[model samples]
Target chain A: MHVSFQVQAGDFSNAGKVSSTVKGILKQLNLGPAHIKRIIVALYEAEVNVVAHSYGGTITCEVEPESVDIMVCDTGPGIPDLDLAMTEGWSTATPEVREMGFGAGMGLANIRKNTDRLAIDTGEDKPTRIHMCFDLADGATHA
Target chain B: MTLRDVVQIVDGTVLCGDDNLGREVHLGFASDLMSDVLTLLADDILLITGLSNNQAIRTAEMSDILQILFVRNKRPTKTMLDLAKEHGITIITTPYSMFRSSGLLFSKGLQPVY
Candidate 1:
């Protein structure tokens, strides 16, 4: 089964809703605990990015017996420097978002650490798309 | 350590899912950064933090944490409690500072999540 959603910026009230829904679906699909955890973590980081940066965006998840693939896309200020953006402890999130317990510059790194395969494509203020896959066996992806 | 032990150490008031106090937690993460908690391997974890936002509950719920400890007597509002209830997570309030509450847990053999 595949799941997708639109994530909106500054929509704190419903920020995590997409991730929660994906969690329920993954649980119902009988995905293993480790795999499910990876999916949820990646989903959350993507969702948080949309809320904190983009005006709003879409999240799509493709689930197979072997793996789960997720894509989070948004029309926000695209990463000026993808390398820096991918670094741990780097963040461009505003103070308000930080106060809400997010924007620690850990979103992409956390997603990479949790998922098995990650690919990113972005252009400033254009659409930024992050593609991540978590293997069912290990729930880890490098680079 | 278990949620019950954390509760006992902090002298915290149970806000929800008190029945789950018996659940065991393998590790604890103390942080106000939801993203930091997200970096943890989401298995049998406990969250201790001073953050009172709804995001804290949401993050814990997604991570399937066994318990939440809001230190410094920072009680969660009715909305936050409801969120915790919906996620089947136990929330406890301790008058102790965040450092003290987590310190007590560490002394009691609760491992920290890296």
Candidate 2:
């Protein structure tokens, strides 16, 4: 089964809703706990980026018995410094996002750590698209 | 230590999963930051937090945390409690602040996952 969702920017109130839904689906599909975990972490970080940076965008997950393909697309002010943005402590989150217990700049790293494969496309005003692959063979590739 | 030990140490009110108090929690992650919780790695851990929301349950779900201890009397919404129930995660609330709760747990030998 496949599921797609729109992730709105600054919608911190419901940021994790999409990822949570995806997780439930994976569980019902009988995916291994390891695979489900990677999918959860990757999709969650991507969702956070959507709300923290983009003006809103979409998160589409193509779920199959073999693997789950997740793509997060955002159309907001693009990252000017990809290198800096990837740093652990780098953050552009608002005070409110921080107050809600987020924005420590660990999203991308967490995604990379959890996922089996990762792809990125970005530029100034150019929507950032994050493509992540999680194989059903126990996504146990954590740091 | 056991979930029961954590409850007693923090003076927490059990919200759900009373039957599983015998469950054990080998580690603890004390952060309201969902991001940190997501990235943290541990097994049989009890998550202690100040953030009372559905996301807290979501984090617990992803991390395989069996229990959630909300410090400072942060009452989770009905929706949050229901979500935790679905995940089989025990929820507890306490008047103790985050620091005090965590300190007590740590003193009792529940170290951070990191």
Candidate 3:
């Protein structure tokens, strides 16, 4: 199955709706609980990043019998430094974003932790796109 | 510990999921940062946080966290409560600070998810 969602910039109120919907679908598919949890966490962080940072974005998910693929793309002032952005405690979020209990610089780290394969396409003044895949096979080891 | 015990230990009031007070939570994770909460890998975690917002409930849903204990008397908004209810996540509000609430729960045998 395939699905897509539009993410609005600064729309914190509805940030996780995409992840929630995907979760429901995955549950209905009878995916393992741990597999569903990892997908939700990665997609949620990516969704929140779009809401909290980008101008707006789109999240697309392709669920297969053996794996799930997620792509989050956003119009942005993209990351100036990929390595720095990947650092656990480094963030460029404004004070107002901090007040919302996000912008802790853990989003990407969490995404990395949860996904089986990941890639990013981004640059300053360019759109940011994050691609993540999760293995759905039973008994697969997770980080 | 059962959510009912957590409520009494922290002088809390149930804002939602009253019917689920019997659910047992084995670990307590205290943080105001939802990102930190999302990084947790354990199961049956009771999120103890002071940050009250839609994201808190959303975080719980994504993390598969079944319960949240809001400390420092931070009240959850109607949107948050509605979301919590939809997710079947129990919500509790406490007058104590995060430190106090964690300490109290720890003293009462709520293990930490380190």
Candidate 4:
């Protein structure tokens, strides 16, 4: 099955809607609880990143019998330093974002922790694309 | 501990999910940062936080947390309560601070998720 959702910039109120919908779908598929949790957590962090950082984005999810693939693409002032952005405590969120209990800089780390395979396409003044894959079969990849 | 015991220990009022007060939580995680909360991988966690907002409820929903203990008397908005209800997450509010609430729960045998 395949599905896509639009994410609005600074739309904290509706940030998790995509993840929630995907979670419901996964539940109906009878995926393992652990797999569902990890997938949802990663998808949520990715969704929030677009809402909190980029101008806006689209999240697309493709589910197969053996794995799930999610791609998040956002119009952006993309990350100039991928390594720094990946650091656990580094963030560029504004004060307002901080007030909302986000911007602790764990977003990408959480995504990395939960996904089996990940890729990113980003740069200054360009859109950022995050691609994440999770194995649905043996669940051996989870740490 | 069951959520009922947690409510008694913290002198909390159930903001939502009163019917779920009997639900048991095995671990407690206290944080105001939603990102930190997202990093947690455990199940049956009672998210204790002062950040009472839609994002906190959303975080709990994504994490599969069934209960949230809002400290420092931080009452959740209607939107937050509604979101929690839709997800079947129990919400409780306490007058104590985060430190005090966690300490109280810990003293009463609520294990930490570390």
Candidate 4 regions exceeding 4 Å error are A139-143
DockQ winner between 2 and 4, please give it: 4
Among these predicted structures, which one has the highest DockQ? Answer: 3
Clashing pairs in 1: A90-A105, A115-A141, A116-A140, A116-A141
TM-score-best of 1 and 4: 4
The residue-by-residue lDDT of candidate 3 on A69-143, one tens digit each, is 999999997988989999999999988778878898999999999999999999999999999999877743232
Candidate 2 clash pair list: none
Chain A: TM-score in each model: 0.91, 0.91, 0.94, 0.94
RMSD in angstroms, all models?
3.2, 3.3, 2.4, 2.5
Q: List the residue pairs that clash in candidate 3.
A: none
Give a tens-digit lDDT track for model 2, residues A123-143.
Answer: 777888889987766533221
Q: What lDDT is obtained when candidate 4 is compared to the true structure?
A: 0.90
TM-score of chain A of 4: 0.94
Model 1 ranges off by over 4 Å: A137-143
> Model 3, residue B106: displacement in angstroms?
0.4
Of the candidates numbered 1 and 4, which has the greater lDDT value?
4
User: Per-residue CA lDDT of candidate 4, range A39-91, in tens?
Assistant: 99999999988999999989999988789999999999799989999999999
Instruction: Please give, for residues A44-133, the per-residue lDDT of candidate 1 as tens digits.
Output: 878988898888889998887767888888886788889999998888889989988998888988888887788999866667889888
- How far off is residue A101 in model 4, in Å? 1.6
Model 4: DockQ vs. true structure: 0.87
What is the C-alpha lDDT profile of model 1 across B1-114, one tens digit per residue?
667778888888888897887788878789998987887765777789999988998899788785888989887888888888888889889999989988889999888876
Which has the higher TM-score value, candidate number 1 or candidate number 3?
A: 3
